[model samples]
Target chain A: MQAEPEGFDRVLSSMCTEPHPVAREAAERFLATNPGDPGTYPTVAELEDRAITMLGDIAGLDDPSGYVASGGTEANIQAVRIARERARTDGIESPTVVVPESGHFSFRKAADLLDVELILAPTDETHRVELDAVRERVDDATALVVGVAGSTEYGRVDPLGELGEIAHEAGALLHVDAAWGGFVLPFTDHEWTFAQAPVDTMTIDPHKMGQAAIPAGGLLVRDEALLDELAVDTPYLETTSQATLTGTRSGAGVASAVAAMDELWPGGYAAQYDRSQANADWLATRLADLGYDVVDPTLPLVAADVPTPTFEALRDEGWRISRTGTGELRVVCMPHVSRSMLESFVEDLAAVSGRTPTAVPTDD
Target chain B: MQAEPEGFDRVLSSMCTEPHPVAREAAERFLATNPGDPGTYPTVAELEDRAITMLGDIAGLDDPSGYVASGGTEANIQAVRIARERARTDGIESPTVVVPESGHFSFRKAADLLDVELILAPTDETHRVELDAVRERVDDATALVVGVAGSTEYGRVDPLGELGEIAHEAGALLHVDAAWGGFVLPFTDHEWTFAQAPVDTMTIDPHKMGQAAIPAGGLLVRDEALLDELAVDTPYLETTSQATLTGTRSGAGVASAVAAMDELWPGGYAAQYDRSQANADWLATRLADLGYDVVDPTLPLVAADVPTPTFEALRDEGWRISRTGTGELRVVCMPHVSRSMLESFVEDLAAVSGRTPTAVPTDD
Candidate 1:
């Protein structure tokens, strides 16, 4: 296998093909220096407990138990599996899940993977699921109802409190797919919040809004017994002495998550969320002034309904936004984004709209 | 939520409580450096192809293919799901899987997850599955005959060739649980021989022998049609044109695997197998000569059947090793392990056996 060089050379050759050498080198050095048994590395058997405590603190759930998974998809699948088993235990025939039309597609995938029937609640003009529709869809056979804390298209927060109330009334579990908002919601200045929900479980992606490396999403259960129903262990790998859909988690990813949580606490997200919201509001205002129909003008995510030609024109003018199939463009503002990036996007937008001529992007 | 700074003074604070400032800086730098469609920043589409190509390369198959999963456990579940459908298609009354007793326990877990009957077949004294027993277990109700390449405890390679042939002769599919040996066998200097019978599927773990960062494993299928039988997709995240499961994969993990493959192919693992095998062989001979009953003296992995007193004695001599329930010590020789480590292990064994230590561990 050693053509003419050594193992180190082979490693270097692989590194060359990586997207970012500096980042890859940094990642490699980080791995080499911090190689420790994650089970005991970050403090022994308390790894899972630590994750649980962190989720509780973030979601404002006084008592919660977290199960780390590879990503949001697996976490969603595990949540569905637990819900299905709960329905079976409750003597429900043909368990059904009530999910919003705007909910992550993982909802349907989870239902399919677990062989449970999925019932998608219809959305309103703004793409928010209709609370009345969700209430009407729930029945005695309902296993679980999903509420998206942050919809992918517009980053719109759903009516979790209303949905949770409806699902709980039907004797069904209310699960929140908060993969993008868990790290941000705690810092929101709103009042009637997610903390008021009769929610039973939630999914959070540390790799997304939390800004950690990949493979570090989790499913947090308000009722730990629910997770117990899905617990599985094998002889090759030690899982939560109960049940788990996946086994052999990467310790490196676990460490990164722990590291991400430690960094996110203590008002870290307050500043990031505030800046992001401000930028999004500004972008929405600017785009609307340019005659685009903006959704939820005050939100930190701007979705503008524009024709394909307008979108291509903006792209030609150097904007990197995406166009949804329904003639909407989504612009996300993360912490890494700067005011200058927004200004540049706006300048390009203005030019595309024929309202300005060759306005240069500002640095500030 | 920002609290009073700790003793580490916001340095470890940034790393522990918040996301890595370093990775954020890298993402920022990457955004500034490549300021277009952060979509290229590892999009769902790119991840889909990368996963399919990566899994295909591992199983030696082609595309319209597999999906990225959490690990071998998830992969096994997908494989079993497909096999079950295949049985259903053939109208089997009760689909049964014939698995070697020495196979990874995940196979059993997969069967249990899918509600399929499992027939455990005994292996020979060397821990290889007995072909005659496997042949006897296959019937019209058989879905898959599972084989192991290298077992966890004894590191014995099953006669995959004979087992594959028997499964095919019985009109059953052969699934090779080569999670451990997949990366090893393809690169080892040992004879390149396997029974020429068609292998329907295989599971390989890049996290282990492939030396990629964890949470990278795959299920490969020879006939891509099997994936279609189990294929389920969602709009939130795309899989291959056909897939077994669908969701947004950990893009960074998929990127890391691509990097790992680039490091492993064409000669990456070629020399590693040579060094590891040499070390294992040397350790086996030394242990056997010192009056220890080494399991599979001819294989690259050496498991020594020792008394409790012998184990305690070795532990006292400052040797750290794995132990099976049956008082057997197991050692895995991998690429990073130096030969001197093996020599030192041998010397420790000799001393524990009341013999003089001839070799000392090299400090390298």
Candidate 2:
């Protein structure tokens, strides 16, 4: 067999990280099982229920109705499908969804697939969706209004509560894409959950920051009835109706999600958020000290204004980094990222930029 | 953690089977890597390319253009999306798709999500799709015509060459769903691939008869240009455009597919299919001798007319089996199935029906 690929030790730009030990074990155990046929694989189905319950607790919903999606893209697409169906029932001929320009590209795919008009609302100075712009785009024909809890390019949380109000006033539903922020926002004071706002649906992925295996993306709905729009009558298998986008999904992701949440929920996730946030802050301070423009570390993601040549040099030096749409260097401080790794990155950055290292007092 | 779910010991009705040992090892090695961002994870991305090449060789396409989908559902959905986009370019505002009544439920989900009209064509007495019904239902607005290579209900193959001709006559694309039959059909005389007909797209799942891990579904297109309709601009990622439905897909499925195909291609799959076909024939003869109506054992799947009470008793006795839409007991002889297992099932079936077993010569 071919040698295993390089580990995630130097991957600082991706939202995904290495799976938790328990999550890996769980995934291996259930790798061959299919959770799509719930009646045939009852154990994994029950595990999926437990995963949803735990996710509901974190998202501030007493009762949650959702499934483990293939990823955040599937969850986001399903949310749009529900909104479109609801609007069709209310006599809307051509449905439209208002999403921030800072939203992930999955919304664009959803708009194209579902044949809904996509209206991109501008963002404010903080990189959050502009409230005036969102209000202007949403009208009576709007089916859904999307808000990003922690955006991909810039880790800025949108005003979810006010976005919900604007959507509801226009007879539309609110969907918050918190795929990257759901695991960390519980440690902060962000009103981005079902309890704080009238969020009809939310996308929270376990594989991103929850340290679960890949494909464990969550799609939570405030009411179970919302899933009825996506249901299709399954003739042959055990289940009568299936709501998920993909049939024959593996039980590995469902089991891994349950295992990861059981191992680290409120306490472990809180500590991880603190460490990752501190690392982002440290990197931002170092970059600013070097006379580079840096975005505020609202979450655990940092963006800095490094020259194109310097960014290319850093990448050529075996650092798995990426850049934002506006050509700023972007790095996501996932759980696998450590303080020493960031220090080494700074040394490389200093060398690539041809600048002397700043002398600072060491706490240790 | 909770005990692992029951193994696939008595699972005789599911399309999925236990993963090959090599596939399991490959899945474990690539569990945390995301193939969605191919620039960061080049190893798994190259493995995905290898998988597509092998799939193309098996599907009779020299140059296949597709990706590793989450499962057959996503592949089927993408096929419909491609056809719909092509039809729209031809000035068709409201597109429709014609599928056999025996088609998988995923097509229903696709039609609903893509906002297309779904017209179900009647099936013939042999459980194959009636070409006349498909021709009568198709119109200028029809975007695609779907055919089943190995149907989920009765393990029947539709006349793919004729279906393609009828679809082409109506200016519609032909999509063959060979998800369950792709692996075994190479050993048979079935004309269900790109070389046999004018098939525009095909869905073949590695997790099914290919003995790979779950979520290793293949979507093959004859021409690369068909994928252009699904592309979306990915800004932050290194790749400029992505055509996949999911954003962050796991590399486990991609690596497992390559490993499984490399280990077991024509020779190994042919031997296994021979053994499975013999087992299915043996079971079908035993049930027929017991005075029950039985469908022909086509493609290693047997459907028999067992009484409802007997079927319930078999389930109560822990035999993992399912039924068809017409209520015939269905048994799919997967790679894990053995002759002794079928003999045990027959003994239980005889007991449940209050019948004495006939003495037959055993080929030990």
Give i-RMS (Å) per prediction.
Answer: 10.9, 1.0
TM-scores for the candidates: 0.79, 0.97
User: Candidate 2, which segments miss by more than 4 Å at Cα?
Assistant: A357-364, B357-364
Top model number, lDDT: 2
lDDT of 1 at A17: 16
Give each prediction's DockQ, rounded to 2 decimals: 0.20, 0.76
lDDT of 2 at A364: 10
User: What is the TM-score of candidate 2?
Assistant: 0.97
**Which pairs of residues collide in model 2?**
none
Number of backbone collisions per candidate: 18, 0
Chain A TM-score of model 1 comes to 0.82
Per-residue CA lDDT of model 2 for A266-340, tens digit only, reads 898999999999999999999887777899999999998888888888889888888999999999999999999
Docking class of 1: incorrect
